[model samples]
Target chain A: MPEPKALPFSARDATCPFDPAAELYELQEREGLPRVPVPSPIMGEFEAVELTRYTDAKDAMSDPRLQMGFVFDPEQPRTMMNQPGNLLNYNGADHRRLRRMLTSAFTVKRIRGLLPKIEEIVDSRLDALEAAGPGADIVHEFSTPIPTLVICELLGVPYEDRESFQRRAKIGLDVNTTREEQIANLAEMDAYMGRLVAEHRRSPGDNLLGSVVRDFGDQLTEDELTGIGNMLLVAGHETTASMLSSGVALLLQNPDQLAVVRDDPEAVGDAVEELLRYCSPAIALPREAAEDMVVNGQWIEKGERVVTSLLVANRRIPGAEGDLDVLDVRRTPAPHVTFGYGPHQCLGQQLARAELRVALPALFKRFPTLALGVPEDEVDYRTTALVFAVNKLPVTW
Target chain B: MTLKVEVDEQRCVSAGHCVTSAPDVFDQRDDDGVVHLLDGAPPERRHEQVREAALLCPAAAILLRERDGSA
Candidate 1:
């Protein structure tokens, strides 16, 4: 087989943090699906077909023959991947089975029921932000805690353990972290989740994990419960937290759009959707071809990997309205694969949307004159993580 | 101009796009969280919003049939 060509693909542009690297857009214009070298800390460097167009992305993601389980090497000792209930570790029937177990936990109705609690969390965080006065790191003071606390409450994880879990979650998502560090962090989190699962086994509470123990305890193994807890714990907060911080920075840059999101209560939902499309938090969703297939006219052999760039796919030309690359909160709702597409699309999307819909507008309403504490150029954007986010958004009202 | 709407519960992922678009016409069952059609034939004025709701459904589970037999 001929060697795959290496393409320059970075998650975000240094010049424009919100946009994908210009080279990716150029590649999309020329070749919609190009084979490129993707480096992983666990598996080192390998070739994967990169899908950049919106239609092609949806097609590849939705194709059952393309499986997510093959993305990781069989030899890898990653605990999360080896575990049973880690949804990303399985495909087809196994994936559907595991996914069905948790579906009700994140349903729109269930999430809406949590709104009062979410509002309380948002309000308390806003109160803390107010007490901190101006020049606080919005990332640490505001963005991180709301989701952290909410997810903790949902999963029945003790609020006191958040700092440790949050740290591990950060290490887990960072692409630049060494494989050893990733394994160590995953091990620590697994141990922690094991204890939580054991506690729930003794006495189930009202939260998701507790409910699982109560409802499906006999059907599930201890490892499965731990894996489920860890997946929800990490995925529950990290993506939404990244969106919160980065969304703030994006809104801060576009003041007029910020005004629309803040002033019009009815517009918050659409604004959140526009922000999800524009920001494109989770960068790429990786899958592997289980069989020989042609996607967007590009042939792929069995066992070859395919990675969909959510950033580029969502930003494809002729967006919902006006330019796809630009951030306009007023744009009509356009379908973007930010949460991904197909059967394995984000299960927590409704929950994430609920948090964003409430958190963004509430933050802006509480601090109407919010602006960046540092100059625009100096804001640190996390470039090497699976999820795109700001390192620290220093802000002042 | 009443509109007929039906939801295939098996296909629904509970993305909530339908309910968000037209809360009055669509909701989710409290138990499994699948889409529950609150109004099979909504009023004339709500047809456009119901159509938008069907379009927004990621699962394509929501089917709308207009009174004229047009979907």
Candidate 2:
């Protein structure tokens, strides 16, 4: 394959420490906002396009020509990037079909029904925390477990197997993990789901896995089920965990904000929005252009992979009228691209909301004295990985 | 009073703040960590607490409004 034309700049020039957002902001300053050719060690070698501006990114998300599962370089081998067709990568009819089928699981009404169960899990985890004492790693002790258990239950996976699967899922998302290790973790998840799918086929349960097997047993292939399971499993747990752990950690650091939340737990919804904008866990979503396109006035060729930095877009950018970054929960009709935009919007958004709705307020009320165990600078943020997250958020109440 | 409550599930990252604020009204199921509203209307004594719950929502999924006619 031939090398693509040189980008106007290097990521290092625009890089923000711990957050690549600085580079995006730099581009925004240059009036070269969208399609800025974000240089990625991964995308650079592959000659893919990069997207930044909100409008272009959303448009590419809904575009039909851009293929999700299509492999540009056959020699690159089928790895995590080449996984079977799913909503995030797929376009047109297949995308519509899969989206429709999974839509019900994400609706607010459907998610609202799961609240009681969500509370039970959180309480149970808090009970364990009491046993462990005041100082605990909220990420592992509380944040990680709650969502892992929840998604496991949703997928019908035995709760007992959650720790191991969670380990595998965590490894799969680790960008620093050796390519082989990453691929191995993904394969391990796929194999595990394969067995579950087979078992469910023989004697299906009432879980999401069994439902998929029953409803689209013929249409949804085993790998497809596994793919969807992987999506649900990883996405379902990881991002939500980041939000909880990070949200608490942030509140602990910002006492005034913490007091605001403590005074009105219902403000959790607004606080979460500000947090999502403030700390967008899913920092960037990679998209590829199927044909020649111009975004934010920059020309982007076909077959280039682009990533929109939602973290940056949510913080600083001119919106319809005012600045988009103001962190005011009272800002009425505030819309965020944190869950993403257009066709690829997060399928598990409602479920994510319900979890926060129950968890955030409960956490504060349970431990009114809850505050960070360490300084804000000391908190371990997930720096190298694709997802902007923290490794461990230690807190004490 | 209208006893208005708004839920922005989108803002909810499933942090479980509401459940702690008002256990009787908010909860986290064993099944999923997502927050749900068990009772549409919270108790009067807990109203202030529920207001706190709404504020703490990491996803900002919960909002409260006081109805003009009743409390």
Candidate 3:
């Protein structure tokens, strides 16, 4: 593969946690693929296309030619345990059907109804932090607990086993863990979810897992349930938890932004939207072209694998006008591709929003003087992480 | 004239930008993840934000029009 030349722009280098678009856009100009290649052993085997331009990325997302359900060979580096009929590996009507069923669970009203529960979870976790006194790692003590507990509660996973479940969830994403270790963690989670579902089947609860089993009992096979459960575990917990830790840290680092959020709690909604756009946690997911298509004069053939960087697309581009990159909550109408676009956008977006809305404001309301416990330089940025996050975020109140 | 907004469900991507922009009038449903119009018209004060939502609707599904007793 030929390396593309860098573009002439001075955006934040890839290292800057605040704005990493400069380097990303440069890669976009380079042969239209981000220089940071998708880490897949099958790079030579598959035709990899990188969609970085705003129009191209959005087009790729909405294009019917792109298949969402294509499962790369399991031997590939990023392959998870293969389960047939999982939502991630479906396209067209199948994708639509699964999305319809799951989207309902994440509706704003449903999520809003869970606000009190979300608050309880956030506050209880915060209480634990306060009891532990200063210098507590907020990521482990506060951030992880809220979402972990929320997912467990939502999926009818017993809260008693939460700490262990949280440990397994983290290990599931640990790069340091050998592939075998990761696979083991996945199997453990699957088994736990399997047992939890079985218990729910014997005596159904009001949570999402029971609902799925009840409504789609005949439709969802055992493996399907496990796949959906695992999807929820990763999507329902990791994304929200990462946002809480990193978003709060970003606000703390940018005191001006934090002050804006503090002055008017109403800004929490806007701040959360901005944070989604700014951080764009899940950087790239593999997408394959279902048919030949043209995007911005570039022709892409069928059966091609393309990765869209929502991170870079959310930021300002050289040819694009307006402040797409700026993290301004007050922007009258913000346009962000954080939750994604088209048919497969985000099933849990409203739920994620609700979690953020409740958690961020509650944190400030409880600890008005909250600030980062450690210096910004001392903080660890999950740079190589697929889901942008921090391992530890210590905050002082 | 009482202004009203409508989202063509077919074109709607369930982005919930409408809900975020004008939560009082537009809310997403807990089942099937469809957008529900809470009120025909938001409070007169929030009319501006609603207008902004119509313009920002990527799918162009949201339509804003003035309503009178006789249409």
Candidate 4:
């Protein structure tokens, strides 16, 4: 295979914002895993191998040799990465130790326990949307707040502090933000989490953070507790919020699929899976090779970075059924690397699934005639961010 | 028919997919969330749910085999 082109991190096809860049797909088809330049705000630009095949992406995610800790440059003051107990900053035993602490909080049974609250939150959001009248930005009025509030309750964040926390989280996740801004946002959130952790230490609530404080207060340090709180607060809301907004936009584009999600109760689970695969909220997850190893027949040297394009890999050939690129809610759920794969597969996926299942159906069912308030092409999709999302999804009944 | 169930502790992230799918057959330790097989040889009636639990294990940690050396 010829030397692959050095593509920028934010390069996506402008014509089809939903799909990965044409160059990425073409390179993957020609050379299963292509070498490309990955630009990181904290680490600057560096060469990294891109995994585009779904099978390879899934398998490589579990490879012990591929470490996530080195994704950031050590010299740079990555406050978020340096935070103790941040799962993404660790691999192997350390990662497992931190992860296990919160695993019980996100177990299927625990998530199922939270279903009633999730439903109530979804219903309340819908009520607000309706009362606001038609022509509301679904991203703001509906998609964003539901997960934000749910996470607030889960992390024991005060309801009054949600808006400020949400603002900081959005800024923290934005790749477009400057290093100074990112650090500032992280510091602010860190302080907020510290206060919350202290409060939990005195009297732990039933929420995730509080439970950890109550159960293992002696084992965990203040920094570790705050880190756990920060990770959940940001990840719990932002990723799901992206899916909610983008999933709605994608459904509107295909009314046939929309009808299936809206009307068929049995199809909701599969619909959420399909949407997760189709939307590919978090574009790529970056990992560093802990040691030299062969991944998908490519020789990746130790310390080299490997970035897997979840968006492209999920949409690769031989998908669920029919064309992988097309949105079909009725299609059987095929394994995709959207929530990622391996031991580190998303901790809160079940909760995210429950949110989508309840929220999407209720949104469409409540307003059967719900349509895009703006032109389809005019819908502003987020391109430069780590997560693929729409800027605003304006809709009307 | 009897179901022989095993959980690879190293691979298990304690997502609880197995526990949720087959509660009677699987349980998790209090110290860590990793699952443990409650009934190694469950009756024939629970075969399907046990298999479903194995299939749903996100980490691919759950393994099931029959006494006759069949999966």
Determine the backbone clash count of candidate 2.
Answer: 75
The deviation in Å at residue B44 for candidate 2 is 31
Estimate the TM-score of every prediction. 0.92, 0.76, 0.84, 0.91
The list of candidate 3 runs beyond 4 A from truth reads A1-14, A29-36, A41-47, A71-81, A174-182, A317-326, B1-15, B22-30, B36-71
Docking class of 3: acceptable
In the predicted model 3, the residue pairs found to clash are: A65-A290, A69-A89, A69-A90, A104-B32
Candidate 4's residue-wise lDDT over A251-325, tens digit each? 998999999999899889889988998878775457888788887677888888888878788887453578888
After superposing candidate 2 on the true structure, give the runs of residues whose Cα lies further than 4 Å from its correct spot.
A1-20, A33-44, A69-77, A317-330, B1-71
Which structure is stronger by lDDT: 1 or 2? Answer: 1
RMSD list, candidates in order = 3.6, 9.0, 5.0, 3.9
Evaluated with DockQ, which candidate comes out highest? Answer: 4
Could you tell me which 10 consecutive residues in candidate 2 chain A have the lowest summed lDDT?
A5-14
Can you write out model 3's per-residue Cα lDDT over A1-397, one digit (the tens) per residue? 4432211111234457656655566776666443233443222223367776666777778777777645535454333535443577777677666666676677666777888998888889878888987788878887777887888888777778877777776666544345566657767877887887787678778988888888886787776777787778777788888888877888887778777666787677777878887777765457777788777778777776777767777775444345775666665435677777766777778788888878777777678888888888878766544466788887787
lDDT per prediction? 0.82, 0.66, 0.70, 0.81
Span of ten consecutive residues with least summed lDDT in model 1 chain B: B62-71
In order of DockQ, best first, we have 4, 1, 3, 2
Q: Per-residue alpha-carbon lDDT of model 2 for A1-397, expressed as tens digits?
A: 5533223221211232223345566655555434443333333334345555655555555455555645424366445665663456566556667755565565455577788899999998888776777778888788888888888888888878887787887676655455667667767888887788889989888988787777778887776777777777888888899888877777786677777666786576777777776666774456666788776567767877666666655555344335554444434324456777554667787788778777777777788887788877777776555555668777776
Top candidate, metric TM-score: 1
Q: Scoring model 1 with DockQ, what do you get?
A: 0.49
Docking class of 4: medium
Each model's iRMS: 1.7, 8.8, 2.3, 2.1
